[model samples]
Target: MPPTVHDRPRDDRGYPVPAITPWEDGRPQFALTDYQRSADCARQRQCSVCDVLMPRGPVWRVVGAAESAAIGAALAAGRPYRNLAPTLEGPGHRACMLYASMVCPYLARPNARRALTAEHPDELTAAVVRGAVRGALGAVVGFADYEFAVTGSRVLFRFVDVIEYLPHDNADAHLAELRAELAGHGGGPARPVG
Candidate 1:
């Protein structure tokens, strides 16, 4: 099940609209939850989790350790943030950020040991641009480096890279837990796996 927007604003149909990922073929794939999209068309203020426009400013993000190391490497290589939505973190309201950190399987699980997984690393690193916020329309423009902070377990990651399924000993259990979290939140039927 997906989150029911009983008291929240949503798309025209009133269902919880998941964030969309545009494929190479231009087809859109909707994630079970809101994932970040380019804020190019004045949409950066949208919360990636709740699929709604953020009512206020001061965007929040949650980055994991894997992405933390990756971002550092990218920056060292001369790649800039340039407003590209971090594969791990994106713009969102305060509440939405909290919701995802507590429930999203990708973040809920303990960080994968980069050393142990070196034999067959499941993560992919890519070069991407990060967008900057400008003006009152909330349109994010200009490709420039942005600063990020890591507080406690939450880190900030703004770049491209897809996380297909990662192979791990407890992968199945983690997926189950994610599904259970979705169901408990009143989201529609759970996908068979993460």
Candidate 2:
């Protein structure tokens, strides 16, 4: 069985840190991820926000122009999205995506700059998946299109793809509309039922 949160050490805030056999061997902190689960569970990828396995199907990512360009270029070139490293945080469900767009501060933040630059991520990305096994986002073995972000170091990483675009200006309204539609279908927010 996978080690429970109690099995891990805690930070000053009492949040679980990474698992370690001994204090000397462990880092001060580690972000918990589905990969940390035991073999059986690790095979399933959990949504970062919902903590549920991402369902299989078309996953969505909210992207800006820069990201769209990368995806387009990769598709045209028939190449895998290549970059310096994997920053993709797995995937998420559509309901989760809608909820996030409505409430996420990052998405709602004012644009730092009007143009893409090397100093910061030119593209904002988020994932929404459907039909995923065990609702696990990590279950996606491969992606057809390539996405990337240009770094100050000039290195690129295989970024996650943006299946859909959610503009910051109208995200709230869009999410509200989606929420109403979902409600009509008896769907609700992605929060835990309990």
Candidate 3:
């Protein structure tokens, strides 16, 4: 039997959220529990066992004026500060910075470049897997270039690429699934398989 809703994890607050990746059957393999000591997660915490920095706030629900803008506009413009209810500039526009940094083949870190080091030859490279999984995820939703993070062995989502106004096409359904995955409602506490 799967864990009950009570088995779910939470944040600094007492919310019953899911683990990033639950210990399930067949999935990408990652251990999220190791970071318990390092991360500032004690309140409503469960381990991803992989040290994933998931979205701390709300799940992204992208919307646009008529269509999604490009990745550039969304992040820079704040006027839509919930002020512009529906603008073509979608969420991707705002979160592009994160992708340009985290997913880049080059040094993604903004201020400094870490040496091209630690080759995860033995198993799944978290970042690489993240990109792939996110890609498939976007395919399901009809978008691209979403910024993401991992936690509790699952891909906890914080943001989505809404620019290009594409994701908005089926925003409701897609958002629901993505949010479910991030919240650990996607499945069991299964570890990644690699």
Candidate 4:
């Protein structure tokens, strides 16, 4: 049987392991991306979570509330929102995206703050710093045609003609349900990781 998102192997800190998360010194670094895998996923139009090729059509992505609102406004104004902003992660299947949003501590918690470590200084680290500055209330799942752009060693996604956007109110209620479910299974609420 395929493991549910809650059943996936977790790191020492208990974050579920995503297929695209990079490993370093034999440990998964949830904060970093494997650039090669990211590029390959983009090239193959694969889902970041499941690593399966997605059907041709709108690709789904999760973005901060601010970016989502901007994209929504642009779509409403009939303005070209494509390449208006660069996304850190590649697109994925809607189900995979939702599963990720549900399982990921940062995305699930509206007031969640990203922990910045000074040990690794890289493009991703800079991006993390930027995200911390902007602050995130919740996230939005949106679908659109996308093109990949390589900036340094990172693969960024630029959306074209976003068709729909679903804003999550931080999923607080859903998270409570998930926590209860986990507890029923003898697992507890997901622990915060740095």
lDDT of every model, 2 decimals: 0.36, 0.37, 0.28, 0.62
RMSD of each: 15.4, 12.8, 16.9, 8.2
For every model shown, the clashing-pair count is 18, 18, 37, 0
**Descending-TM-score candidate ranking:** 4, 2, 1, 3
lDDT of 4 by residue, 50-132 (tens): 67777787666667656756766666687756655566678875555655666666676666656554255564444465235
Highest TM-score, which number?
A: 4
lDDT of 2 by residue, 68-177 (tens): 35555665576544334454343344555455444433333333222222223334222222211111011111232333343433222243333333344435655554
TM-score of each: 0.35, 0.40, 0.19, 0.71
Candidate 2 stretches greater than 4 Å from native: 1-42, 68-85, 112-163, 184-194
Give candidate 3's TM-score: 0.19
* lDDT by residue (tens digit), candidate 3, 10-40: 3345433333322334332122312323223
Where does candidate 3 stray beyond 4 Å?
1-34, 37-71, 75-111, 116-155, 160-194
Model 4, C-alpha of 99: deviation from truth (Å) = 1.7
In Å, residue 115's CA in model 4 sits off its true spot by 1.8
Alpha-carbon error at 18 in model 1, in Å?
Answer: 3.0
